[model samples]
Target: MTQHRPDTLSHAPLGRESAYPEHYDAGLLYPIPRAVNRAPLGIEEGALPFVGEDEWHAFEVSWLNAHGKPIVAVARFRLPAQSPHLIESKSWKLYLNGFNQTRFESRQAVVDTLLRDLAHAAGAPVAVELLDVDDAALAVTRLPGECLDDLDIEVTDYTPRAEHLAVGEEIVEETLHSHLLKSNCPVTGQPDWGSVLIRYRGPKLDREGLLRYLIGYRQHQDFHEHCVEHIFTDLMARARPERLLVLARYVRRGGLDISPWRATPGERPPEPLRLSRQ
Candidate 1:
């Protein structure tokens, strides 16, 4: 097993689209190879490291017209999990900013162009909904304070009888805990930090292996949502748990903290546990 190291990622302004590989198709959604897999470490099941979520920044972006006037277009984007190209969030942000200086004859043109560009970039079917910014209602805000760091954690050396345990089978369910800590932009190497939680019920999972897997992402570079999904899928595939829930509550960045949860449609995730930046 490799020893953990302090993160040393640096941050810089966004760059051109050509800087990244064109794996995602503009018309489809897909998954890419993850940092956890690339990292040098042996990951088993239970002892996965935890990284807090709430460390991302989305500018609550607005578009401007050629006359430098603000133009409001509400959009909802959905990218397929199987798309070839995974549009980097920073690049997406920059791409959205580009529209600020450009002109579109109508709101529909703006929406269509954005959907097309995003879909093409992701290489998957990307969905977008356009509404008047003033009329569009934002999703409910769950966390409303400076990120809290006070968490009562209980760490147990979990041992699974099976080589792998089933997912969502009370793998470790008690108080909130973080597994791994990692944050980085693929294009600029800007680091984003967060804690992760894995709750499951089935068979007992291997604690040490899970920890190793979490620590393995120390040097990984990926977005928060992608990271959470990657963790969820990896566990599902490796453990084959009967039930599983992967929820990441990232610290706030740019006035927004994204929390992505994936589980059986009917399953309900616990309330968000907001963590402070370490």
Candidate 2:
């Protein structure tokens, strides 16, 4: 596959400041082509190897109900990984802000608008659900896996080093996670912190080396989805796992949080769980 670099997203509203929209305007949404990053990773368009979704949570979602009374609620959006584009974070914030003052006859009206706009921007059918702000399902929970944060290892370089990944002779199936996963936004250079969960069945991965490999991403610059995909790809190349699943739950920023996961065919996806730091 021919490799291509990601386009400079200087025109996007990611690192720039702009006035928020006062009314419902779908034009506020900006779509970044997923191919820009996938190409460099050797992933071809329309032939993704994983089945997953980018799950987004918006906490500041609100709008005016019938009679212009304020209605507040949280929103969850799920976009398939095969989507041609992913909505830029800042632009998504601005797009959602447009509903702040807009009046809708019912909750369904707001949901319909969100579904239509997000699905169009993502270039795939999106699932949008509005939940009460205090919904019990939104409670914070711990990642279900053997935590790797306590591993004592010396790290000199922060740049991603895929060579650090290795596997042992023993075959095993296990789940491992770490809260140290972090990367910068390619356009904004802002830090994005998240917890990563890895589940696989194959040659036992070197736990120390795995932690070192993840820590190396501390200074990497990429989008949340791309970072997760990079980790998945690197592990596949090094460990050659029979079954693999990589999921990252990033902390919320600008009133929204993004969690992306990639898994091999027939692998079960993890449950939607909010991390403590999210």
Candidate 3:
């Protein structure tokens, strides 16, 4: 195992150069290596080295073969949280494009097969929608909220780090912010940029410690959702707050901006709001 030093920002390089270009085809689908399938869990539940929700990013998506010619098929899909299989989004995107040169008997067949594959990977049923040009308007919705640009917070540094926090305090309110923003595709290492927000209620958290830990991910490689989950779990253990929420709004990549939210059972996430750069 390699130990990451706080001062060594360059120690862990991000996956940037591998980012796929916008015009890349979507027919070339592939699977993640079995070795990398290790569940990104820590030594124990709520441990500091927590695995975030963004690790499940995947899409085996594609469009129908209109006119028997390969064209980009706009697709929208939703995976159930109950699924055991989690598709890596970067891999999904690549997988979808892998089909650009391939042929399908019908759009329904394509959709059905994709649903089965994604469901298997997610360990739950998945839904997919093929969008026509007219349906583009309804295909995607903008996230809810004010832009995060110009939304600045005081930065501080703290120490005495532990692997996790023990649950104790009943958090009434809290705010966590980080400016260490960088975006990179899981497969191509292309940069996907954005900001993150964490709010909860419980005991008073070490503001400086939280900020330092958030900044520590400056060079870390992972998806937006995964990053937020990692933060949420880490704080849950370290701060042991009563209620917690994690939200991450990433900048647009390939005409799409992904924001993921997760909380304890019965917890609700705020509506997706647009941030400044969004």
The best candidate in terms of TM-score? 2
lDDT of 2 by residue, 1-278 (tens): 11112244767777887898888788777788989899888999889978888999999999999998999999999999999998888888988898999999999999999999888878899999999988987988888879999988998989888899988899999999999998998877889999999999999999999999999899999999999899998998889999999999999999999999999988866665987788
lDDT of each: 0.49, 0.89, 0.51
- Write down the lDDT that model 2 would get: 0.89
Sort order, lDDT high to low: 2, 3, 1
Better of 2 and 3 by TM-score: 2
Q: Which stretches of candidate 3 lie over 4 Å from their true place?
A: 1-62, 65-74, 80-85, 98-110, 131-171, 174-180, 183-192, 206-209, 223-225, 254-258, 272-278
Worst 10 residues of 1 by lDDT: 1-10
**Model 2 bad stretches (over 4 Å):** 1-8
> What are the C-alpha RMSDs, in order, of all predicted structures?
10.3, 4.0, 8.2
| 91-199: candidate 1 lDDT, tens digit per residue | 4544555555666666777778767776665555666666454542433333332221333334342222222323334554332235355656665666666666666
Per-candidate TM vs. native?
Answer: 0.53, 0.96, 0.59
Model 2 weakest 10-residue run by lDDT: 1-10
Please give, for residues 70-182, the per-residue lDDT of candidate 3 as tens digits: 54445656554333334444445555555655667788877777777666555457677666645433334443333333434554422223342343345457555554556
